[model samples]
Target: MEKDRRSLILDCAKELFATRGYHSTGISDIIEKAQVARGTFYLYFDSKRAVFDVLLESAFETILSSVKPVIVGPTPDRNNILKQLRINLGRALAPLFADRHLARIVVSQAETLDEVAAARMEAFYAALRHYLEESLQEGQEKHVIRQLNTKIVATAAVGMIKGIVWTHATGSESFDYHEVVEEIVEWAAMGIVTR
Candidate 1:
Protein backbone atom coordinates (compact mmCIF):
# COMPACT_ATOMS: atom_id res chain seq x y z
CA MET A 1 0.00 0.00 0.00
CA GLU A 2 2.81 2.39 0.87
CA LYS A 3 4.71 1.60 -2.29
CA ASP A 4 1.55 1.85 -4.36
CA ARG A 5 0.73 5.29 -3.02
CA ARG A 6 4.25 6.48 -3.71
CA SER A 7 4.04 5.16 -7.24
CA LEU A 8 0.65 6.78 -7.62
CA ILE A 9 2.04 10.12 -6.63
CA LEU A 10 4.91 9.62 -9.04
CA ASP A 11 2.60 8.75 -11.90
CA CYS A 12 0.46 11.80 -11.28
CA ALA A 13 3.49 14.08 -11.02
CA LYS A 14 4.89 12.69 -14.28
CA GLU A 15 1.64 13.44 -16.06
CA LEU A 16 1.46 16.94 -14.62
CA PHE A 17 5.08 17.66 -15.44
CA ALA A 18 4.71 16.42 -18.99
CA THR A 19 1.80 18.73 -19.50
CA ARG A 20 2.83 21.70 -17.37
CA GLY A 21 6.62 21.66 -17.55
CA TYR A 22 8.69 21.27 -14.38
CA HIS A 23 8.99 24.96 -13.63
CA SER A 24 5.27 25.41 -13.86
CA THR A 25 4.29 22.39 -11.81
CA GLY A 26 3.70 23.04 -8.13
CA ILE A 27 3.44 20.85 -5.04
CA SER A 28 -0.23 21.72 -4.78
CA ASP A 29 -0.83 20.69 -8.34
CA ILE A 30 0.81 17.32 -7.76
CA ILE A 31 -1.06 16.88 -4.50
CA GLU A 32 -4.36 17.67 -6.17
CA LYS A 33 -3.69 15.48 -9.20
CA ALA A 34 -2.56 12.61 -7.02
CA GLN A 35 -5.75 12.94 -5.00
CA VAL A 36 -3.73 12.74 -1.87
CA ALA A 37 -3.72 15.01 1.14
CA ARG A 38 -1.07 17.67 1.23
CA GLY A 39 0.40 16.02 4.30
CA THR A 40 0.33 12.66 2.56
CA PHE A 41 2.27 14.11 -0.33
CA TYR A 42 4.72 15.65 2.05
CA LEU A 43 5.24 12.26 3.60
CA TYR A 44 6.30 10.89 0.21
CA PHE A 45 8.11 13.86 -1.32
CA ASP A 46 9.42 17.03 0.26
CA SER A 47 8.76 19.20 -2.80
CA LYS A 48 7.72 19.11 -6.44
CA ARG A 49 11.35 19.02 -7.49
CA ALA A 50 11.92 16.06 -5.23
CA VAL A 51 9.14 14.24 -6.98
CA PHE A 52 10.59 15.20 -10.32
CA ASP A 53 13.97 13.88 -9.28
CA VAL A 54 12.48 10.54 -8.42
CA LEU A 55 10.65 10.47 -11.75
CA LEU A 56 13.86 11.21 -13.61
CA GLU A 57 15.71 8.51 -11.69
CA SER A 58 12.98 6.03 -12.45
CA ALA A 59 13.15 6.83 -16.19
CA PHE A 60 16.91 6.39 -16.17
CA GLU A 61 16.57 3.03 -14.48
CA THR A 62 13.93 1.85 -16.91
CA ILE A 63 15.98 2.74 -20.01
CA LEU A 64 19.36 1.70 -18.65
CA SER A 65 18.03 -1.62 -17.39
CA SER A 66 16.98 -2.49 -20.92
CA VAL A 67 20.54 -2.15 -22.23
CA LYS A 68 23.07 -4.86 -21.48
CA PRO A 69 26.59 -5.72 -22.50
CA VAL A 70 26.44 -7.72 -25.69
CA ILE A 71 28.26 -10.94 -24.96
CA VAL A 72 30.33 -11.94 -27.97
CA GLY A 73 31.49 -15.51 -27.85
CA PRO A 74 34.55 -16.73 -29.72
CA THR A 75 32.21 -17.54 -32.58
CA PRO A 76 29.56 -14.86 -32.44
CA ASP A 77 26.58 -15.23 -34.73
CA ARG A 78 25.90 -11.96 -36.49
CA ASN A 79 22.21 -12.74 -36.75
CA ASN A 80 21.98 -13.44 -33.03
CA ILE A 81 23.83 -10.23 -32.22
CA LEU A 82 21.48 -8.25 -34.40
CA LYS A 83 18.51 -9.95 -32.78
CA GLN A 84 19.83 -9.04 -29.37
CA LEU A 85 20.26 -5.44 -30.44
CA ARG A 86 16.69 -5.33 -31.65
CA ILE A 87 15.47 -6.86 -28.43
CA ASN A 88 17.38 -4.32 -26.35
CA LEU A 89 16.03 -1.46 -28.36
CA GLY A 90 12.50 -2.75 -28.03
CA ARG A 91 12.87 -3.27 -24.31
CA ALA A 92 14.27 0.20 -23.82
CA LEU A 93 11.45 1.75 -25.83
CA ALA A 94 8.48 -0.28 -24.60
CA PRO A 95 7.89 1.57 -21.36
CA LEU A 96 8.44 4.92 -23.01
CA PHE A 97 5.82 4.08 -25.61
CA ALA A 98 3.46 2.94 -22.90
CA ASP A 99 4.01 6.04 -20.78
CA ARG A 100 4.33 9.14 -22.87
CA HIS A 101 4.09 11.34 -19.80
CA LEU A 102 7.33 9.96 -18.42
CA ALA A 103 8.86 9.93 -21.87
CA ARG A 104 8.01 13.58 -22.45
CA ILE A 105 9.57 14.58 -19.15
CA VAL A 106 12.70 12.58 -19.89
CA VAL A 107 13.18 13.75 -23.45
CA SER A 108 11.93 17.31 -23.12
CA GLN A 109 11.62 18.77 -19.63
CA ALA A 110 14.36 17.06 -17.64
CA GLU A 111 17.33 19.32 -18.37
CA THR A 112 15.33 22.53 -18.36
CA LEU A 113 14.32 22.12 -14.74
CA ASP A 114 17.42 23.51 -13.03
CA GLU A 115 21.19 23.28 -12.97
CA VAL A 116 21.20 20.22 -10.74
CA ALA A 117 18.58 18.61 -12.89
CA ALA A 118 20.52 19.57 -16.00
CA ALA A 119 23.69 18.03 -14.60
CA ARG A 120 21.86 14.86 -13.76
CA MET A 121 20.51 14.64 -17.29
CA GLU A 122 23.99 15.25 -18.69
CA ALA A 123 25.47 12.52 -16.51
CA PHE A 124 22.77 10.09 -17.56
CA TYR A 125 23.51 10.65 -21.27
CA ALA A 126 27.24 10.47 -20.64
CA ALA A 127 26.81 7.14 -18.95
CA LEU A 128 24.79 5.86 -21.88
CA ARG A 129 27.42 7.08 -24.37
CA HIS A 130 30.16 5.48 -22.30
CA TYR A 131 28.36 2.16 -22.33
CA LEU A 132 27.77 2.39 -26.07
CA GLU A 133 31.37 3.38 -26.75
CA GLU A 134 32.65 0.49 -24.69
CA SER A 135 30.36 -1.99 -26.45
CA LEU A 136 31.35 -0.69 -29.88
CA GLN A 137 35.03 -0.87 -28.95
CA GLU A 138 34.55 -4.50 -27.87
CA GLY A 139 32.73 -5.30 -31.11
CA GLN A 140 35.54 -3.76 -33.14
CA GLU A 141 38.18 -5.66 -31.18
CA LYS A 142 36.26 -8.88 -31.84
CA HIS A 143 35.83 -7.97 -35.51
CA VAL A 144 32.06 -7.90 -35.14
CA ILE A 145 32.05 -4.15 -35.83
CA ARG A 146 33.98 -2.33 -38.53
CA GLN A 147 36.64 0.27 -37.81
CA LEU A 148 35.17 3.63 -36.83
CA ASN A 149 35.37 6.33 -34.20
CA THR A 150 33.40 4.72 -31.38
CA LYS A 151 33.05 7.99 -29.49
CA ILE A 152 31.38 9.81 -32.33
CA VAL A 153 29.19 6.83 -33.14
CA ALA A 154 28.08 6.48 -29.53
CA THR A 155 27.29 10.21 -29.28
CA ALA A 156 25.29 10.14 -32.51
CA ALA A 157 23.41 6.99 -31.54
CA VAL A 158 22.36 8.46 -28.20
CA GLY A 159 21.30 11.70 -29.86
CA MET A 160 19.30 9.79 -32.45
CA ILE A 161 17.52 7.79 -29.79
CA LYS A 162 16.67 10.92 -27.76
CA GLY A 163 15.28 12.53 -30.88
CA ILE A 164 13.21 9.48 -31.79
CA VAL A 165 11.81 9.10 -28.30
CA TRP A 166 11.04 12.81 -28.17
CA THR A 167 9.20 12.58 -31.46
CA HIS A 168 7.30 9.49 -30.41
CA ALA A 169 6.36 11.07 -27.12
CA THR A 170 5.29 14.47 -28.39
CA GLY A 171 4.63 14.29 -32.14
CA SER A 172 1.10 14.81 -33.43
CA GLU A 173 1.48 12.04 -35.98
CA SER A 174 1.46 8.61 -34.40
CA PHE A 175 3.97 5.87 -35.31
CA ASP A 176 4.89 2.46 -33.97
CA TYR A 177 7.88 2.29 -31.65
CA HIS A 178 8.42 -1.36 -32.62
CA GLU A 179 9.04 -0.36 -36.20
CA VAL A 180 11.27 2.40 -34.94
CA VAL A 181 13.31 -0.14 -32.97
CA GLU A 182 13.74 -2.31 -36.01
CA GLU A 183 14.69 0.70 -38.07
CA ILE A 184 17.33 1.62 -35.51
CA VAL A 185 18.78 -1.89 -35.50
CA GLU A 186 18.81 -2.05 -39.29
CA TRP A 187 20.48 1.33 -39.49
CA ALA A 188 23.12 0.22 -37.01
CA ALA A 189 23.68 -3.04 -38.86
CA MET A 190 24.20 -1.22 -42.11
CA GLY A 191 26.56 1.29 -40.60
CA ILE A 192 28.33 -0.42 -37.70
CA VAL A 193 28.13 -4.18 -38.01
CA THR A 194 30.73 -6.04 -40.06
CA ARG A 195 29.46 -8.28 -42.84
Candidate 2:
Protein backbone atom coordinates (compact mmCIF):
# COMPACT_ATOMS: atom_id res chain seq x y z
CA MET A 1 0.00 0.00 0.00
CA GLU A 2 2.73 2.44 0.89
CA LYS A 3 4.77 1.39 -2.13
CA ASP A 4 1.78 1.72 -4.37
CA ARG A 5 1.07 5.23 -3.14
CA ARG A 6 4.67 6.23 -3.70
CA SER A 7 4.60 4.85 -7.20
CA LEU A 8 1.34 6.64 -7.84
CA ILE A 9 2.92 9.91 -6.86
CA LEU A 10 5.91 9.23 -9.10
CA ASP A 11 3.75 8.36 -12.09
CA CYS A 12 1.63 11.45 -11.63
CA ALA A 13 4.71 13.58 -11.22
CA LYS A 14 6.26 12.16 -14.40
CA GLU A 15 3.13 12.97 -16.36
CA LEU A 16 2.93 16.49 -14.96
CA PHE A 17 6.63 17.12 -15.51
CA ALA A 18 6.43 15.86 -19.07
CA THR A 19 3.38 17.91 -19.91
CA ARG A 20 3.83 21.10 -17.89
CA GLY A 21 7.62 21.55 -17.75
CA TYR A 22 9.50 21.44 -14.45
CA HIS A 23 9.59 25.12 -13.54
CA SER A 24 5.93 25.68 -14.24
CA THR A 25 4.67 22.58 -12.52
CA GLY A 26 3.89 23.03 -8.84
CA ILE A 27 3.93 20.66 -5.86
CA SER A 28 0.20 21.15 -5.40
CA ASP A 29 -0.31 20.10 -8.99
CA ILE A 30 1.47 16.79 -8.39
CA ILE A 31 -0.36 16.23 -5.12
CA GLU A 32 -3.71 16.81 -6.78
CA LYS A 33 -2.83 14.69 -9.77
CA ALA A 34 -1.65 11.85 -7.57
CA GLN A 35 -4.81 12.09 -5.51
CA VAL A 36 -2.68 12.28 -2.41
CA ALA A 37 -2.63 14.77 0.39
CA ARG A 38 0.16 17.31 0.84
CA GLY A 39 1.51 15.42 3.83
CA THR A 40 1.49 12.20 1.87
CA PHE A 41 3.61 13.74 -0.87
CA TYR A 42 6.12 14.99 1.65
CA LEU A 43 6.26 11.58 3.22
CA TYR A 44 7.41 10.11 -0.08
CA PHE A 45 9.40 13.02 -1.51
CA ASP A 46 10.61 16.12 0.25
CA SER A 47 10.06 18.35 -2.77
CA LYS A 48 9.41 18.47 -6.47
CA ARG A 49 13.12 18.62 -7.12
CA ALA A 50 13.63 15.43 -5.18
CA VAL A 51 11.07 13.61 -7.27
CA PHE A 52 12.55 14.92 -10.49
CA ASP A 53 15.97 13.75 -9.43
CA VAL A 54 14.65 10.26 -8.84
CA LEU A 55 13.01 10.28 -12.26
CA LEU A 56 16.22 11.33 -13.95
CA GLU A 57 18.18 8.62 -12.19
CA SER A 58 15.63 6.03 -13.13
CA ALA A 59 15.81 7.03 -16.78
CA PHE A 60 19.58 6.82 -16.72
CA GLU A 61 19.50 3.32 -15.28
CA THR A 62 17.04 2.20 -17.92
CA ILE A 63 19.29 3.46 -20.70
CA LEU A 64 22.38 1.81 -19.26
CA SER A 65 20.65 -1.51 -18.84
CA SER A 66 19.52 -1.46 -22.43
CA VAL A 67 22.95 -0.63 -23.85
CA LYS A 68 25.15 -2.75 -21.59
CA PRO A 69 24.81 -6.01 -23.43
CA VAL A 70 25.98 -4.60 -26.72
CA ILE A 71 29.03 -2.83 -25.35
CA VAL A 72 30.29 -5.32 -22.74
CA GLY A 73 31.88 -8.21 -24.59
CA PRO A 74 34.99 -9.38 -26.36
CA THR A 75 35.75 -7.25 -29.39
CA PRO A 76 34.40 -8.91 -32.49
CA ASP A 77 35.56 -8.80 -36.10
CA ARG A 78 34.82 -5.77 -38.28
CA ASN A 79 31.45 -7.08 -39.51
CA ASN A 80 30.33 -8.15 -36.03
CA ILE A 81 31.54 -4.90 -34.52
CA LEU A 82 29.40 -2.95 -36.93
CA LYS A 83 26.45 -5.18 -36.16
CA GLN A 84 26.95 -4.68 -32.43
CA LEU A 85 27.31 -0.95 -32.96
CA ARG A 86 23.96 -0.81 -34.69
CA ILE A 87 22.42 -2.79 -31.84
CA ASN A 88 24.06 -0.53 -29.28
CA LEU A 89 22.76 2.61 -30.93
CA GLY A 90 19.34 1.11 -31.37
CA ARG A 91 19.04 0.13 -27.71
CA ALA A 92 20.32 3.52 -26.59
CA LEU A 93 17.48 5.26 -28.41
CA ALA A 94 14.80 2.75 -27.46
CA PRO A 95 14.03 4.28 -24.08
CA LEU A 96 13.83 7.77 -25.53
CA PHE A 97 11.42 6.57 -28.16
CA ALA A 98 9.41 4.78 -25.51
CA ASP A 99 8.95 7.92 -23.42
CA ARG A 100 9.56 10.90 -25.65
CA HIS A 101 8.02 13.34 -23.24
CA LEU A 102 10.56 12.34 -20.60
CA ALA A 103 13.27 12.62 -23.24
CA ARG A 104 12.10 16.13 -24.06
CA ILE A 105 12.08 17.07 -20.41
CA VAL A 106 15.61 15.77 -19.85
CA VAL A 107 17.08 17.08 -23.10
CA SER A 108 15.43 20.48 -23.32
CA GLN A 109 14.39 21.43 -19.81
CA ALA A 110 16.65 19.78 -17.24
CA GLU A 111 19.92 21.64 -17.81
CA THR A 112 18.64 25.17 -17.22
CA LEU A 113 16.17 24.31 -14.49
CA ASP A 114 18.52 24.15 -11.51
CA GLU A 115 22.00 23.34 -10.38
CA VAL A 116 20.97 19.88 -9.22
CA ALA A 117 19.39 19.07 -12.53
CA ALA A 118 22.38 20.37 -14.43
CA ALA A 119 24.71 18.31 -12.26
CA ARG A 120 22.67 15.21 -12.83
CA MET A 121 22.77 15.76 -16.58
CA GLU A 122 26.53 16.23 -16.47
CA ALA A 123 26.98 13.02 -14.48
CA PHE A 124 24.79 11.17 -16.96
CA TYR A 125 26.87 12.40 -19.89
CA ALA A 126 30.08 11.50 -18.11
CA ALA A 127 28.95 7.93 -17.58
CA LEU A 128 27.97 7.62 -21.23
CA ARG A 129 31.29 9.03 -22.41
CA HIS A 130 33.17 6.68 -20.12
CA TYR A 131 31.34 3.68 -21.53
CA LEU A 132 31.93 4.77 -25.10
CA GLU A 133 35.58 5.45 -24.42
CA GLU A 134 36.08 1.99 -22.94
CA SER A 135 34.35 0.34 -25.88
CA LEU A 136 36.43 2.33 -28.39
CA GLN A 137 39.62 1.44 -26.56
CA GLU A 138 38.71 -2.22 -26.72
CA GLY A 139 38.03 -1.91 -30.42
CA GLN A 140 41.37 -0.22 -30.98
CA GLU A 141 43.23 -2.90 -29.04
CA LYS A 142 41.58 -5.63 -31.11
CA HIS A 143 42.30 -3.87 -34.42
CA VAL A 144 38.59 -3.53 -35.01
CA ILE A 145 38.98 0.19 -35.70
CA ARG A 146 41.84 2.37 -36.93
CA GLN A 147 44.22 3.97 -34.50
CA LEU A 148 42.72 7.27 -33.40
CA ASN A 149 42.11 9.35 -30.32
CA THR A 150 39.54 7.30 -28.40
CA LYS A 151 38.67 10.09 -26.00
CA ILE A 152 37.88 12.58 -28.74
CA VAL A 153 36.09 9.96 -30.80
CA ALA A 154 33.93 8.88 -27.87
CA THR A 155 33.01 12.46 -26.96
CA ALA A 156 32.25 13.32 -30.58
CA ALA A 157 30.17 10.20 -31.07
CA VAL A 158 28.15 10.84 -27.92
CA GLY A 159 27.65 14.51 -28.84
CA MET A 160 26.52 13.63 -32.34
CA ILE A 161 24.04 11.08 -31.04
CA LYS A 162 22.74 13.48 -28.40
CA GLY A 163 22.23 16.26 -30.96
CA ILE A 164 20.38 14.02 -33.39
CA VAL A 165 18.30 12.34 -30.70
CA TRP A 166 17.38 15.66 -29.11
CA THR A 167 16.29 17.02 -32.46
CA HIS A 168 14.30 13.93 -33.28
CA ALA A 169 12.62 13.87 -29.89
CA THR A 170 11.69 17.57 -29.81
CA GLY A 171 10.89 17.90 -33.50
CA SER A 172 7.36 18.30 -34.81
CA GLU A 173 7.57 15.25 -37.04
CA SER A 174 8.15 11.67 -36.01
CA PHE A 175 11.40 9.95 -36.96
CA ASP A 176 12.29 6.39 -37.87
CA TYR A 177 14.53 5.18 -35.06
CA HIS A 178 15.82 2.18 -37.02
CA GLU A 179 16.80 4.28 -39.99
CA VAL A 180 18.45 6.85 -37.78
CA VAL A 181 20.41 4.13 -35.98
CA GLU A 182 21.50 2.66 -39.31
CA GLU A 183 22.77 6.00 -40.53
CA ILE A 184 24.62 6.64 -37.28
CA VAL A 185 26.23 3.20 -37.31
CA GLU A 186 27.24 3.61 -40.93
CA TRP A 187 28.85 6.97 -40.28
CA ALA A 188 30.67 5.64 -37.24
CA ALA A 189 31.88 2.59 -39.08
CA MET A 190 33.10 4.42 -42.18
CA GLY A 191 35.33 7.45 -41.74
CA ILE A 192 34.80 10.55 -43.85
CA VAL A 193 38.51 10.77 -44.84
CA THR A 194 38.88 9.31 -48.33
CA ARG A 195 41.51 6.59 -48.46
Task: Give the per-residue lDDT digits (tens) of candidate 2, residues 18-85.
Answer: 77888889999999999899999999999998998888888888888778534434635566667777
Clashing pairs in 2: none
lDDT: worst 10-residue window of model 1 = 168-177
Q: What is the TM-score of each predicted model, taking all chains together?
A: 0.96, 0.86
Which is the leading candidate under TM-score?
A: 1
lDDT of 1 by residue, 55-160 (tens): 8998899889888788889997899889989888888888888888888998889877778888999999999999999999999999999999999999999999
Candidate 2 regions with alpha-carbon error over 4 angstroms? 69-75, 192-195
RMSD of each: 1.1, 2.9
Report backbone clashes per prediction. 0, 0
